[model samples]
Structure formats: C-alpha cells, structure tokens
Target: GAGVSQSPRYKVAKRGQDVALRCDPISGHVSLFWYQQALGQGPEFLTYFQNEAQLDKSGLPSDRFFAERPEGSVSTLKIQRTQQEDSAVYLCASSLALGGEMAGYTFGSGTRLTVV
Candidate 1:
C-alpha cells in the first residue's frame, strides 16, 4: 500500500504562472480530497471525489484552483494565475469512502506551493 503520496514536496512559481501538483492515493480507497493549508491555519477543503466523480468542490478558493481525479486513483490540483496568497501546502487525502465521520482519511505530507 502506498498510503498517500504527493510529488515535488515543494514548488516555487512566479505570479500569474500556472502550476500543477500531483497526488496518489492508497489503493482500493474510494474517496479522495484536496486541501490547502496556510501557515498556522488548519487545512481547508478544496474538493473531493468519490471514485471518478467529483462529489464536492465548494471549498475551492477560486476558479483558478481546479482539481480532478481522472481515473479514480491519481489526482491533480492545478492552479492558474498563481498569486502570493496561493503560497501554501496542498494536501491530499483518501478514505474507504465519503461517508460517516470520515475518521479514516489518510493524508499525504503535501506539496508546498510557493508563489512569488
């Protein structure tokens, strides 16, 4: 089992540039979620998918932030027109399913996106 993994661990981008971060969830998991964490703040939900269907995205900060789980396992979060405010850690998590208390969500170390 790969747990959950994110690539680049860190990223530096110029303002207005676009960036894409990647995530790989644990095998057999049925739910995936993306979150953003600012310094000293808790993770804020960005979007979620059950299998290949995006079930929720209400927490996406803006239209520039987009996420997708194309094949129900690997996911990507793409930010268009990066801004300084977008500097933060992007986290990915997965669970057996998006039900109940979500107590089994496993999180990755995250990709730290820094926009300058």
Candidate 2:
C-alpha cells in the first residue's frame, strides 16, 4: 500500500466481545507501531515491531491486549472481553527505519471501537 491502512473504521462491541483491528503498512517499511487513544487524550503507544520481530509491547494495558506482525507487512491488534473503558481509537503507523525524526511514521486513520 502507499500508506498505512486500517479496517473496520468503526465498531460497536457488546461488553465482553472480542475485537480485532487490522493494519497494512506501506510496502518495505521496517518499523510498525500500534497506539490507543481515548477521547480528548493523545495516542498512547501500545506496541512496536521491526520486521517480523516484536521489539516492544510494554504499553499494552493488560494480558487481554495483543498485537502481532506475522509476516511483517501487516499487523493485527486484538482485545479480549471488551469493556466500556476499552472504547477508543486504535492507530497504526509504519516507518522505514527506527527513531530518527518524529515525523517519519505514517499513521493510519484508526479504528474507532465503542464497547457498550
């Protein structure tokens, strides 16, 4: 893809339902990231992967959250047993290299999940 892409632009999940958000990054990008954003708050980093290797996942809120880049080109974020507190916009981003310039990441439009 020319830029990052995310699916299910909007979702309304009943409490306790599991949800999966997908991301497709620009071709050949090496670094990918996932973030969570609550209304009125900035995006918070959830995970990062370099190629097929997951380099960091310290920001995930709990064991209920997981992210992966199975082939390194696409990624998925899964949240189990969705809760009202889990409602937020999930963003995905990709970059050619690791940290250098803050503007290097190309972010996806995000998947807005609402747990009711």
Best by TM-score: 2
Name the lDDT value of residue 106 in candidate 2.
94
Question: Which residue runs does candidate 2 get wrong by more than 4 Å?
Answer: 100-103
Query: Candidate 1 regions off by >4 Å?
Result: 100-103
lDDT for model 1, please: 0.92
Prediction RMSDs, each to the true structure = 1.4, 1.2
* Model 2 vs. true fold: TM: 0.96
Cα lDDT of model 1 by residue, 1-116, tens digit:
66899998999999999999999999989899999999999999999999999999999989998998889999999999999999999999989855625567999999998998
Please, what is the whole-model Cα lDDT of each candidate in the order they appear? 0.92, 0.93
Q: Estimated TM-score per prediction?
A: 0.94, 0.96
Model 2 C-alpha lDDT per residue in residues 10-87, reported as the tens digit of each score:
999999999999999999888999999999999999999999999999999999998989998899999999989999
